[model samples]
Target: MSISRFDKKIQTPPENPSQNDHSAPEEAAQIGAARVERVIHGGDGLLRLDGKAGFISGVLPGELVSFAVLRDRPRQFEGVLREVLDPSPHRCEPRCPLAGRCGGCDWQYCHSEYQLELKKGIVAENLRRIGKIPLERESIQILAGEPWGYRERVQIHTDHRGRPGFKARRSEEIVLLSNCPVVTEEINRFLEDAASGKILLPPGKRLVLVLADGESPDSRAVIVAPGPQTAQRSLDGLPLSFDPSSFFQANGPLLERLGRELRSRIARDAPRVLVDLYGGAGVLGALAVSGSSAFSGDLLCVEEDRRNARFIEENLLRAGLKEAQIRVVSRSAEKALAVDPVLKNLDPPSSAVILDPPRSGLSATLRRWLKKGPAARLFYVSCNSATLARDLGEILGAYLIQDVTILDFFPQTAHVEVLVELRLKG
Candidate 1:
């Protein structure tokens, strides 16, 4: 196997902690020593160490941990657990069977409430530290739904050799996964069958990404990214169809709340317009202002992927909405919102623009458009605060930060999906 580009790092390398090298232990190799730098940079109380990448494992920040070198390269080093000479106050036993091998959730050993705090701190740090933007989050709205079994999405992966399960972190090695502790029971059943090879995956496919709709196992949903088209079912009469490899919010109940969180900021007026940027299957735009009996309005969703745009268009028609009622802008958000004058003319003037950009956040041209556009309100949904904070700083002049809700959407992890509501300040 060839060494990947990320493997090249010049850090002090661990001499022996690996099975590949028998002479390492005796050499007393020199490796980079990074402080368990800070959880959420001190928010989560998580002690993720810095310095040489692969040299630290089984040990967290604030506690001395020597890493077991897995692979050493010029630019980076891969490591595994060696020894934890000391432990942090937040450290606890991990409940999952594959705690060490499974790449799903690393902080499962950490407590639940502590996990939420870590997420909060992570958001605050990304905004204030990385982005260098100030946000008074000490008293912010933090929605912690459930610590366990809250995940509505599950992705099952296997190796080419036909072993059923997920690949170990940073490697393609398959780990048998008959059950997942964090997901609902129904998903577990389906996953168990798939893992046991009872449900044969397409001949060569080795991945299964199951996206559920509601909090329970009974929630109807979609499956993609690995294979299989998606069909969504909801009591609210939502019939969603998605391609095999598109971006869809897997959490159903949380997604509804996410939509409600955005809707709470909008005025309850029919005929209102919305520009759903990166509107995967138009879910966000559909959430912003659904064509319910009590509400009547236009939703213009802009999706770059042609296949996703088709799904959005089909979903709207399935709901008995006029084709004109929902305009699927096949162009990029920037092109749709700016280069194409036709998009700005969708509704009288969009009352709100809801955006869910990729981890990289919004493009520069699109950010500038939102700042100067006619949208009265903006709902910025972000999965990564590092990027969000930076983007927020760029468009601060266009909108004022009215409220930020730190939702524990993804628990047992350092990731926090935040919702920021903004109204035009000037």
Candidate 2:
């Protein structure tokens, strides 16, 4: 951790005190080496600088490195990794040449096992630091799949030259790529074809291609263009028709496993009513209803987006849950919860609510509502851990964390999906 370990040695002031004042030497020492203590939630290495926490990207834990300050604030500092003088044993060569440049995959430089470990640590840290929930480290289950080529749906940004790729890290400049290592083989092939002028792309439009189940490179893929294009696909055997702009889980291989896990979690509670908030395309609701017979009451799905709400309605009817009571509210979860007198008055012991919020996590209004008590069993699914921890901190008094599972939906990146089962406290 000494500053002298820097690759670029800092120059010392002259021995002759008369020639130069020692005041400048102190400032030079401040720009020296730092040792990364650990990795934080966003895949940044954490270190101490001037007695404050410093976050630097592209370095691993237990590594002595030099960095340039990117941003300075009162309590924390952000830095860009300059050199890893002493590298971590867990660090590996990134498979993709554009690993650092492309904004898609951030953790490609670390081994897959180490990546999982880092994610587990991040979850644990978030729970403890932000949620005030001290979970046993051994109890956190890490579920993983193929570390590469797991993404089924990829949105490729097109530059002015019509090349499809992703944006650079922390930049708006597009990185034109011929192939992405983390996406499915079918998607890579499509990118190659699109890049080679075999397929024509619309100018200035982002292209989203969703591969159907058991689809090959030559098979007809569901293309979601910028305009009015409706795409239909089956996720874990549930027929779903959604607009191209609608949200769906990016990882295809683990969709069935995720669905099964969710269904199992919901069935254990045997709640009478199932309320799915922020339900996109009604996938979770449909899956829960089709798999579990524990719910004899209404299965309500609340979604804010108009297109997604319509798609949820269509998907529910297509799911053929005719015997089961089903309802889709085309409104925000907060709005629906406030306006519906029945939902507002539901008893916690007999009802369950599934919250699959976006990365922003729970809204302030929803957090306040949950603080007042909502359901007996709560299934919270989150893609961002920081916000999840923040939200959990607000309502942990009324709910107990019964189960936690980490789903590696986005491999080769820092992102991971977490599912938490909460039971109402007695």
Candidate 3:
């Protein structure tokens, strides 16, 4: 016997729905033999639910549990698992106190190895649903890297009256998290120290981006953003900068691997002109080439953030490469590319665009321009595949996807980063 959602039409409760709501009820129940229908990612955002959409948390395939049916949507029912009457063989004890609250990771209750399989399934489903890409289940490889200490950056949220942490799955409520077990001890120490007033954070602040080079033994920079200024630091003799909102990759292990892969591909493309769109600190371009033999026409970086644009220049200089046609366009991606005369005048078939856009995916305007742009190839790297899939669908007729590598950047979780190669279709 289990608490089953009875097609009940749940109404929005009063403004102040006690530390509980109508969906959660008087008691929990023990059920048996619940079938796993399907899994759904709640949009491209952090909310990834399996077993059922709009269903409550803690429900997975092959699990019999007592769940509270919270809210019902047109398509799926949302609920919270009150008790796992029959735990799946893949279920595991979560390691973090903030696991359920932080909402940053949705698959903590699942075993790390099992999570990789789930994510791989998600990718295949997305390709089939969105791109009509027919990939057999056996053809797909579920990829996974190290499960712990993989992230180099952590974005901590702030609150005035509540526990400062990430938002809940589908709501704006901030889940209090003083410590996260999955993060490296280095980061956990910083968070613990911050909790004790060692690091002052703005009250009601939305986020605090912490960045460090895992490879750097003796150096780490603690930079807080949108508030006060922060100090500087370096790693592996590479001049790196971070000031609160400088948009550094949070998962450094995968990023390092991703960077090396980009560098390897650059030799083959041998681009004459390189345009870094949505370029944050110009890391991609910097990693692509060695010291001197740079792009012949122009090496450009475009970013809207003035602070990040400066860091890009500083990074370029530190790499010991001459500023041959290096232009930092201070505008949005499309505006910068469209208005710059030098960028437009590059030699024929000489330009290639490399972009890492914000999670909302590339701007539709930007996608339109790139489809018709003179670039020979486009290397689009994204952490959010949902938006990337959406963007690809938008421009499918314009460009053909050449190659794709789904990176297990955020191991032990459902998040995936992909490096996709695109060439204009005839």
State which candidate has the highest TM-score.
2
The global C-alpha lDDT for each of the candidates, from Candidate 1 onward, is 0.62, 0.76, 0.62
Model 1 has an lDDT value of 0.62
Off by over 4 Å in 1: 1-37, 41-86, 202-204, 211-230, 235-237, 268-271, 291-295, 317-323, 342-350
Model 3 lDDT-worst window of ten: 13-22
Worst 10 residues of 1 by lDDT: 1-10
- Residue-level lDDT of model 2, residues 1-426, one tens digit each, is 533332443354322211010122422333446888888888887898767788777778898877655456899876556568788899898899887778888888899998888888899899999988898767888778999888878787887778788877767778888888888887888889888888778756677777653345334364645555466667666666766666777776576677777777777777777789988888777766664566457778898888778777677765656535777888888889889766788888888998999899999999888887779988898999889999999998888898888889887788877988888898
Best by lDDT: 2
Clashes per prediction?
17, 0, 8
lDDT order of candidates, best first?
A: 2, 1, 3
Candidate 1: C-alpha RMSD after superposition: 6.7
How are the candidates ranked when ordered by TM-score, highest leading? 2, 3, 1
Clashing pairs in 3: 54-77, 54-78, 55-77, 55-78, 55-79, 56-79, 56-80, 225-244
- Model 2 regions lying over 4 Å from their true place: 1-31, 72-75, 213-222
In Å, residue 305's CA in model 3 sits off its true spot by 1.4
